[model samples]
Target: MLSSLVVSCSITTSELLASKAYGAAQTYPVAPDRAWKIVRAIVDTTAAVAVEERREDGVLIATTESHDWHVATRFAIWIEPVEAGTRLIVVSRTVRPGAFPRALSEKEFHRDFAQRVVGNDLDSHGPKGK
Candidate 1:
């Protein structure tokens, strides 16, 4: 397990919905609706098609198509509206343990997800930034 290693980044602004939601979405490059399109593409084009199983109360649950080495896996994305901004919490759990390994998936996630999801916003405006 990752101990004391809280990997997170955020952007803040005066615009409640704008800065909060927009900043949380780094790779959007446009508005929220456009961002959704980008997100949908990522999920659809995954190794195997991953469909959203549950999405309620700012939380999303998705499962990938099972394969030989890649068994079924669940990924959760939690969007929490905080006082200053919205917090995006992400987690992935291995349901089947799979024939290969799940950590590879985790690494893949770290590789492109962060920047694609919210790296742009972070780059544009973060901490003392605009």
Candidate 2:
């Protein structure tokens, strides 16, 4: 029984490690520069550290703090210009196998990003004073 349990645990760990990274993409009605700025700000606020940034190529890599159950979660974000506007693509995965999944998922990250972008737009164009 112990041997079987050990095998099961090993399989689960292997599967987690081998899992493909997942991502989410969204297009915003804004310029790539604006989108890039927003994304960089968001990463700076959320990530433990910024790993690499390629503004010319519109790529930003960052990692979140790691806890007892999991290693740091790595994020790779890409900003691209589209016909309609700017597109943001975010891919995330665990740095290593862990007992738990990433604290934040790609979809959640996009939601937060969209909210921030819209909020920033409102703040910039809203009423002049209170």
Candidate 3:
């Protein structure tokens, strides 16, 4: 009984955290600067607005409030250079309560945003040619 209770509590805590934030990282065949611009474009269009943008730190943060979902979500993105190309990391966090499911929200959030920016010509015109 004690062990079962502990397991249940752990699952509950994990689920709660998962709902609050989702993170995904991907490497693209592009320069970090180009990747940053593409990411800025995607989030500018999809996110309600960029609450904070820091180019020096290679991070951009945006927030959106949806009346339909009755929730506000923030997306934080990081861009860096890898040996082969550029790596982008995105994390979505919910700032307010809503009807969104807690268990799989982060994965869904990542899928929705990452898919929009990957495998495209937008990054082809990097300052440094590929």
lDDT of each: 0.40, 0.63, 0.53
lDDT of 3 at 25: 73
The Cα error of candidate 2 at residue 39, in Å, is: 0.5
- Badly placed stretches (over 4 Å) of model 2 are 1-22, 68-70, 121-130
Candidate 1 error regions (>4 Å): 1-38, 47-50, 53-56, 82-86, 97-100, 103-107, 117-130
lDDT, candidate 2, equals 0.63
lDDT of 3 at 93: 51
Greater TM-score among 1 and 3 belongs to 3
So what's the TM-score on candidate 3? 0.58
Q: Name the top TM-score candidate.
A: 2
TM-score for each candidate, following the candidate numbering: 0.45, 0.67, 0.58
- Model 3 residue pairs with clashes: none
Question: TM-score-based ranking, best first?
Answer: 2, 3, 1
By lDDT rank, best first, the candidates go: 2, 3, 1
Point out where model 3 deviates above 4 Å.
1-22, 97-130
Q: Which run of 10 residues does model 1 get worst, by summed lDDT?
A: 1-10
Q: Give the alpha carbon lDDT tens digit for every residue of 18-94 in model 3.
A: 43334577666778777776766555544453346678877766655445634555566777789978776766655
List the pairs of residues colliding in candidate 1: 26-118, 26-120, 26-121
